[model samples]
Target: MQDLAFRFLVQLEPENASNFVSLSNLHASSGRWDSVAELRTRMKKKGIRKMPGCSWINVNDEVHSFYVADKSHKCTDIIYTVLDSLLLMMKGEIDVPGLGCMK
Candidate 1:
């Protein structure tokens, strides 16, 4: 379905951010980092800006939303630190509870 949508979008417009991002994510998940980098670089050269990711959560009857790469938040440094640690840990052999060690 995504491939079909991507093809259709390509027919209409080949350089839109959403389609590029969707295809880039597909390539990234498949360990095609070179392709991802190429697409991003092409977008940069073409002056196409990718949309920032955003999500919302309800806390104490208030809805709070945050966007990716947003540095205005006070805990941004701490969040990035923990995220970096998790990425480093995941890069090594992980001991899964049921699946055992994954290379």
Candidate 2:
């Protein structure tokens, strides 16, 4: 009951750190260390996340790296399919649940 209510408060105002802190306290009270940790990580990310200045990839066991807005990958069009989906999060238009995958 309290969990749902607290989570709903977070949903209502995701940008408000107080809601997240309340949720984290709830997790801590239950000894849900992992949930508390994940929430803390989310808070840090929500506050400090930034656009990538570079990216890397592995193909055929070879590593390749690229700079911001790179267009050098042979599969750039296909790779960008993944990138486009992630732009909203990168722009901080939405809360990120976990790190996104880039090609």
Model 1: lDDT of residue 1: 71
Clash pairs, model 2 backbone: none
Can you write out model 2's per-residue Cα lDDT over 1-103, one digit (the tens) per residue?
9889989988888888878888889999999999989988988988933345786778899998887877887878987887776897678776666655531
Candidate 1 C-alpha lDDT tens digits along 1-103? 7756765775578768887888788789889899889878977888888778998878799876779878776677987897787786677644435545455
Which window of ten consecutive residues has the lowest lDDT sum in model 1? 93-102
Candidate 1 pairs with clashing backbones: none
* Candidate 1 TM-score versus the reference: 0.51
Candidate topping lDDT? 2
Worst 10 residues of 2 by lDDT: 94-103
In angstroms, give how far residue 95 of model 1 lies from its true place.
21
Global Cα RMSD, each model = 6.5, 15.4
